[model samples]
Target: MKKIYSIPVFLTMMFLVACSEDFLDLKPIAMETEETFYKDFDALDMTATAAYGILCTRDIFDYYIFMGYASAADDVEVGGENTNDWPQFQAVDRLQHSPMLSTIFDSWGYCYKGIRMTNEFLSRVDKIRATDTKVNQALVDQRIAEMKFLRAFYHFYLAVVYGGVPIADKIVDPSMFSTPRNSLKEVYDFMIKDLKEAIPYLKEKSQLAPNYGRVSKGAARALLAKILLYESSYAKNYPGDERFAGMQERWTEALQYAEEVINSGEYQLVGINGERFASWRNPNGGVGGYRWIFTLDGDNSPESIWEIQNVMDGKGWTYTRGSYIVTYFTVRYYYRPSDPTHSDRVVGGWSFNLPTSYMVNAFGNQDSRETGLHSVPVDPKLDPRFATSIGRPGDTILVNDQTEGEKWFPMSFSNLPTQTISRKYECSPQEYWNGRTNDNEGPMNVRWIRYADVVLMAAEAAYMAGDKPKALNYINQIRKRARMSGNTGYPEDLTDISFEDIVHERRL
Candidate 1:
């Protein structure tokens, strides 16, 4: 017991007397201080990287959640032998709210999380001062503006889904937990304000060389047009009501912004002729040969005003197996284990979403854009898109042997006598699955926002504003591009025709 007596007591006293600094010096093994992240250029880049990282999350485009739900709003069908659970989607298509309403709630949360991260980047980047002036201040401002635009975008998605949401412009402390939902008008105002503020600071088309997908003035204008259109539409619901007196004004603004993009000549719609579809189908073309357009890769395609870059191969949390596209779109041909050509590599087993009979019929039994964009034929006499958009069950499709050949497979319903045709977008053969190969992921690029949609939105706005001729002109442009016969139906020409017909034509 000699001298060991007070050892424990002596050590405890020493630890207490050593001062708080010594204890603080112990430091966390892995914890990082907020200041550490804002120390330099690399740190600022990391912030931007974090903002972009949100796109990889499951709720966004990476999964079929957004597209699946949004498409459900239209006449797109739900059930098939290979299709997944479609109760919520079916309810939405019917305009009936169901228990699946939670799906939209989930989307709301995911989108806000993205906005929060983007907000953080915008708020923190100013604290960083780089050594190089050219790449420091101006670049930082541009990045911050880009993040702001992205934040606005995330909010826009939420607004569309839920009509209202809490706008968080920064990472708030836990003390500020309770917040109420803003009105749809309030949110739209905020979105427009952000875009307007960002336009001046945003990089021009020439400044963004390698990073073409980043937000540009044109992108901001495009989004503004969409916002105005939605606002005007909401206003029109209450006609002759002074409640939304500025509806027409907003529509005029939308038209003006769209005109700006058109006059800028910076972007062009992808021409859809004989080789156009095939060109888009090619993997090597990058953005389907449309530079400045958004695609799966970061490559800047002309059509992509602002796009998120998706990598099939990456490490850490960003790593994607690249099976999402195939799994969601591929038909039974790609998922069946017994098929001779089946590679056994692709994990697709269920068809998550399928076009509805109404949507198919909306194409008016022709090769319209709606059909050509998604379906392939199960019956040769039917639309070829049914075969082009969806895949076939057999190795051979009647006489067609080429990859581009008609591979449509039929879908039967108990209530319906005729088999509904499947589209090529939903079709995939097992032989095409390449496991880890990038090619098997299918087309990675998804247009989160596109000029085509903007055009259609303008057309809708024009129609709502009582400019029937203008509406028809815009609608005809889209129809001509799709090679579908133009609509001769006008309000006066066909008073009995429902507005649903207009929406249907737009969908095509």
Candidate 2:
């Protein structure tokens, strides 16, 4: 097994414990230690890539975080064949999550793995000579900026979950193992500092030099805004929390960063009825923009600010390491579709992250959100997004000509209002998943931060900053798109932007 040292133990000792006189007693280095391995830009770049790669792994992105959010949120339920299907998921859904559960530990472990790698890069890269013509000194510095952002990003994740985690900001030494965990306030401050440093060095979208996967200044600023918002509202529950004394200032900062992303005009929503609509594989394809954002082809879509990338190419048991998003969140019993007009595009579900009545009712049978979640079979015309984003009773949900009315409901026996299936992230129509005889893995990208989220953040920040008109405008933009998905125009009557309005929109 890999080392099980707590972050508090490892990171604390990083600076305190020095090599001292032990060098004389130590044996010669055997493996490619930092002294030899971090020799050039190539080495540091590969190391940085590996650091980022950890987040793309199966456990972190698709399975763990996907289920984690669903479980913790009140809008969803952890459903399977039975209540005992997956204990960890059940625990999270029930709000009885344990620290020892692999969900918690695996997340903690991989995040630190990423942190360690980033620290290693930061510690070594600065040591390279500027005259080293083989390495573009400017590029090396930017990568160093990337590593800094990653380190800060990992700490932010840890802080949100296990508050006040140890700060592994540098290379570790033996004495650092005894270091204590820092306060959440300390951690957030560190993260803010790192992101602020990273934003300037990060590339802009028009640079067109880096591939879509790399982090950009927009992402850094967006993440910084996210951090500020979370911190602003975080301490409300804790009375007299000294760490949040500057909460108002932090909130203003949040508004500033959010506005920066908005004014930059580099990223915007992928309107379902706009240019992206024609690119949805087919005009009659059974999916919408929100649904398409998580599909395999949705990578680097304008809506996506940052996402995890993967490709299967039909090589081996690709699902083993590929994102299992479709594998788990898919509609169950896909192998045996009841539709006669089915196509090879659909796959089955595994009964995880089931939507609940609250989730269904959140949309209140409104524009596209209602159609995206449940089938409006009895009245397809009522839902502008019906049939296009989901299945009606007789519509195709399987290959070559399968129809849906054959089954009682979703998941073999799902009844609406009480128990509903997800139209989002359900791997029913992946065009590339047909290679595997048993569709256990899918190739969809995992979108972490997208333009929709940025717009929402801007809306929230605007409302908090007393600019109700701007907040309403931003929120209306999202609603307008939802209406557009149904081929319906968003009415211009949404003028009152209240705190509840912002919250309700976010819930959708």
Candidate 3:
């Protein structure tokens, strides 16, 4: 009887111990604990994917809000406004800040959100087990580097637009909601540090598939070069400020980085010529021609360093469809005289930001860039880019749907006298409203960074560093590529030339 009692006691104890162990194992799989998610590679990849999604947001591209507003606000381009709705943007000439500036502010918010996500990923990944079999530690490192580069890029954009902004490294906790702005110098310091740290770990440009236009070594260098140029210029223009004291040093550094990209030989300029423009008449010829660079399908072009991808057929369309706002704003009914019945359809009657006579006169006498990218008078005396860029009155080209007898189509903008204004940056009439139709040409892919910008930045840096010959060499390369005639404005007597000339060249 004693033996039987001992057995029962043993069984009860064993059952109680098992129950305790089960209670201790109550961790949930669906809601990943910090140890399970951060301690692995799969979770990190998911975070990276999430960060990339931010690039597709409407505020970044899909329309003229970001690039159009910012660039147009400067002297590089102008827009026509027929109405008072977007009055603030029209007031760019007066240097008035308006609601349109919010587009940039929105970009800042999105960029920070992306940065916070990236930081979260980086912080957690660092703590992950080194011995973990599933994680490729190198990839994690590279991704972290990419994230840092992206963060720097975001800050750079902010600095350029607002001159200064608060710098956030880690994800801000809910309790810390408010922060003061940092000086431009402080912001740039942080940006440079981030880019420098990332450069070593980033992959070469060649390794990236066309789809992965994400941050790479070349892009990082390009951005650094651009930042340095801007800093140098700021210092030169506004002296006596300690913030810009190291401008020359930064300019030298900018040249070094830009040269790295140039030597890498990873990018090539797209060849644009009369044949390229004539091919626009072929619908199937879109991708094969340079015009494709203007549309969503060209997001993955080799020339694209970074571009915002837009899709019109999606459920949550980030880009607006219909007549592009640019077309409605810039193109007048008189511009397309072929449709005589619609000659009175002056959609956007008000010319908001008219190109100053000064700007129009500034175009180089033989510069094709101006004529190719804007619409001017039909007179052969004017620049070619004028016709290409903007639709002028009494101009005709072969329409896509032309029949044999009507070998060519005629488009006249005689009534639309202001057709001489810049239109390359603006959307076309059909593109303004209905994005789904082929008639609309406004839903274009926005090229955030490109080779031309990189080249110009390098030239500016070289000039600032007192390397006039090198600067002129770089500038001439771009000029020649753009089909401009004559010697690059870089004068033989560097003493007479001013940095202002270089800046003006860049603006043009």
Model 3: per-residue Cα lDDT over 79-109, one tens digit each: 4434244555445434665544755466677
Error of 3 at 28 (Å): 5.6
Q: After superposition, how far is residue 53 of candidate 1 from its true place, in Å?
A: 1.5
lDDT of 1: 0.55
Worst 10 residues of 3 by lDDT: 485-494
lDDT top scorer: 2
Q: Please give the RMSD of candidate 2 to the true structure.
A: 11.3
Q: Which residue runs of candidate 2 sit more than 4 Å off their true CA positions?
A: 1-31, 208-210, 235-249, 272-288, 312-321, 334-347, 365-396, 400-411, 414-418, 427-430, 437-440, 488-493
Question: What total of clashing residue pairs does each candidate reach?
Answer: 43, 28, 34
Error of 3 at 204 (Å): 2.7
Q: For each candidate, give its TM-score against the true structure.
A: 0.71, 0.80, 0.74
Output the lDDT of residue 439, model 2.
Answer: 52
User: Candidate 1 vs candidate 3: which has greater lDDT?
Assistant: 3
lDDT of 1 by residue, 174-197 (tens): 875678877677888889898888
Which model is ahead, 1 or 2, in terms of TM-score? 2
Q: Give the C-alpha miss distance for residue 464 in model 1, angstroms.
A: 4.1
